[model samples]
Target: MKERNILDILGNAEEDTMEFLTEKCPEITDAELDALIDATEKKYKTKKKAKDGTEKDNNINMTENEVSGVEHSRRPAWLAPLLTAASIVLTAGVVLGSVMLLNRHGHNGGGIEQPAVTATTTSVTAAVSTIATSAGTATGTAAMSTATTQTVTAAETTAETTVYTTVPFVAPAAEKLYVDNELGSIALELFKKDDEVRYYPMGGGIECDIHDGIKFAADPELDIWCIDYSVEGDSYPAVHDIAYYCHVTDSKFSSLEEIKNYARRTMSENRYEQFFGGKMAKDIDNLEYMDTIDKEHTKFWIEYRGKLYELAYVGGWGKLPSVFSDFYPVIIADKTDTSYTAYIPLWYIQVEDINNCICVELKLILDPEFNDWRVDNVEQFDGKHYEELYNMLKG
Candidate 1:
């Protein structure tokens, strides 16, 4: 049978409202219909009782209302009752539809809110479907079930089995850093959120593996993360640069001073000062507390400008000098509550010609000693892996 337009019927005659509803949802028994009507009427009375006197005053002084006179004149006295019935029916449809949608999304483990209608038996499936269709929610069988009881049970099960949580991790940021030197043009950046930081090696341009390498090390006792980098000889032709990571725990000395202290403690003070070109201080700022530490961290790099003097001529054109740069930022590919992945793109320019980029990917875990991140795994991939890495970060 062709469906009757419920709104048009409501406007045409209030007497046909029950007949219209029965034809639309024949599964609704007389007892259920009576219960729905009684519930809706009680709710309407409660709302009416809670209202202020202003609405009553406006009803008496209708002339002061902002609505046009013609519209107000056409409103039927029985329209309120028809609207109340329609609202009740629509609310029931919404409840059922929401349960179906949640079930489809694998959230069917918890009990869903039942419709206001109190069915005597579990066979109100057809009635629920018809009402849902009337309220524009019965789109397809994928979400809607023939058995309303089954659908409700599935949703309830989902609620019982699923646990939702918020995991703490730093999300990557939008800021970028660009490097265009004798090496090549490249972009890199880092993101900071709260106490965590994430890095992006390829920021402004297409995501590619270009920076030589990015190394991350956490301070033993602090939240500080020290970054080290290695640039290939292909970048500058004669130099394969690298900078070792460093961290300072003592506030008395700078990062440089901490490095110097390590060198002094590792070797004889005179030998260390001769290589570093500085005298050891008398204060014993950091070395007194430490027994042994890596002296390489104390190494520093300088630009060394001007012409090459005759007596200071340096030789060996066969192998490039594997020296460290001043500093390079680290890239964060992915992050989690206790772990993260960082990346460094490795690309070199030979005679001003650009080459395909490769990347070093590092997986890091939180070390219990200092609550610091430690490298757990490392992998290398070409630009072809960019899509996969990008998806990993997004996922």
Candidate 2:
């Protein structure tokens, strides 16, 4: 590239004057030169403000060069100083414009075209306006940046909340039923037949042989249904019986508080506080006890009658395992909009006589109060003396 002399292009100016201007100013590109010429013309020509603040065109044409071929007798007295000031102003403008361009586009330039100032200004103004609105700040760019971050965080949180709220409630699968004891989440194997569902905690549903099963005696006054089974002899007139005294009723509970109250009201005796671990009784009367009791497991209690000749209470009973509680691993056997059938394990008796889990089948109706279900009926199965039936000789 050749360095073009400024005096060669401005032959009408004095040689010393041209040399001074070129030495003090940087080499302007064609685009910058055109901008400088236009700015100078606009400032000194076509409009001038009068002392009375009225505008009128001065008709002053300041950029006539040697290329125009318009010769003057002599230059005006103020022309030299005016041209000196214009050259200095143009040099400053060029330097400022280049810095702005490099800051925006970067220093790596092969032949990058400079962006128009008006277009850049408009874009920047619009962006600043948007930031100012969001940040509630008229002029602080730092506030705008902070506000943008907060807005994005809020949007993400709302999206997560929306997804959580939109997801429908799904009942856990039968295999997923678990009891959270000292050891966390002990899985229960589910065995269901019709409405009768059982969860094997010891996983011996197949090994436990039911010689006789499902003899039911109902006490309607107490809303109690007693189911007895025997593994030693027959289900009816059994030698050793495993009895489950289930207190079943058509009851509506608006909340768990009501259910707790019902549990307190319907106990065989006034041992609800002791059994549920509220305020302990002053006397040491031990019908049944728990090692640990909390809201998760102490919601209800089941009386497991170990020895019973008939529906008459022989008084041999204790608190069933916490795994059998209604607040424990209850399997939703069947569910619908208006009603559902829940299979709650009442007791698991594994003794010398019998090894079986007594599960009660309950049909619950939906109530409108708290969208909770109430016990509609307790479905009872009749006694089956399998061992006695098998022992009959062939005729």
Candidate 3:
């Protein structure tokens, strides 16, 4: 779904919005989760303390009023503070629930949310055309059962089983794919998702072995999944690109309006510097180049002025350098979150990193083999936060 429409669905404010973030980002570990929770708790405590002060003032008012000859009576002043605390608690729970859903459904943190989805028993129709075994010794009667109760294992159980029997119910079947190319063909997939082999068929007589590999590292909840698709090679035109995104709850998508509001409010208040109180780009123009990446699985960053602005995108582990350090705002002032390599029609760019500028690289959503417009920087792995995640998720 187009992210623009997701704004209504993505609710990012309303406290504990990171729940949606957790849903969208798969690589977050237990430590990260702890960090997030701790951070949130601290924030809540701070808010509660300030709000409690308001209650104290009201308590003083009621006490003074009761002592005076004002004929009116009122409830305890502490009541409002108690109620506000309760309200905050209730709101936090609801927001947490929404965020969990977003993570499970793989919602995009770029303020897009979808409904939480679980792998229910989808009635996958197996178009079985009885393959007539040519050998005479293969006389067998088979029963094809479409059983819903049949336990399905994701990686544990696969469609590539091999235990033949009179009732050959096992599988080694291929997945079905139906591409709806109306939006726009993804520029990256050097090897189409359905390509028989990990190679590309170019127009000329030349064929390229492009391992459009995408590997995922997901949280145990399986709420969201992210894939890496950086490429490897020595020179520019010989490199690769990457991207991916998983599922997320619809409610999560609806929740991001809060963050947008917060950003706008920060801008309006002119107190964003006081609020965030740290080094983040204060002006939108700082990263205006973000709009350039209009395709899936691509990112556009802004940095560097006179020289080259290194915009980058990648696929596969070998191409990690081009996408990570090479595109970092510090190294080149061009960067993207590595989790974004697999999101098709890539959109989302970090204008500044650590609040600084460097080089800029043009990130191509599906460009393989960087020509004049492309360059390759293939490295096995750089121990990026995302890389650590993919490692933990490997089957």
Q: Whose lDDT is greatest here?
A: 1
Q: Write the per-residue lDDT of candidate 2 for residues 26-144, one digit (tens) a residue.
A: 12222223334445444443222221122113233346563322343344455556656556555544543443333333221111111111100100110111100121111111100
Q: Write the per-residue lDDT of candidate 3 for residues 269-317, one digit (tens) a residue.
A: 2222222222111122222321322232121111122211111111100
The candidate that wins on TM-score is 3
TM-score of each: 0.18, 0.17, 0.21
| Candidate 1 per-residue C-alpha lDDT over 1-395 given as tens digits, one digit per residue, 9 for 90 to 100 | 12233234445645344332222221222222333444445555554543433344345334555543322233344555655755665565454333333333332111111122211111123133221111111111101111112233555445432110111122344232222331121112211110010000000101112232222221222211111112233211111021221121123334344444434332233323333332111222233212222222212211112110000000000101111122332345345577655654433211111123334444555555446444343333443343334444445
2 or 3, greater by lDDT? 2
- Candidate 3: RMSD to truth: 26.2
Q: How far does residue 223 in candidate 1 sit from its true spot (Å)?
A: 41
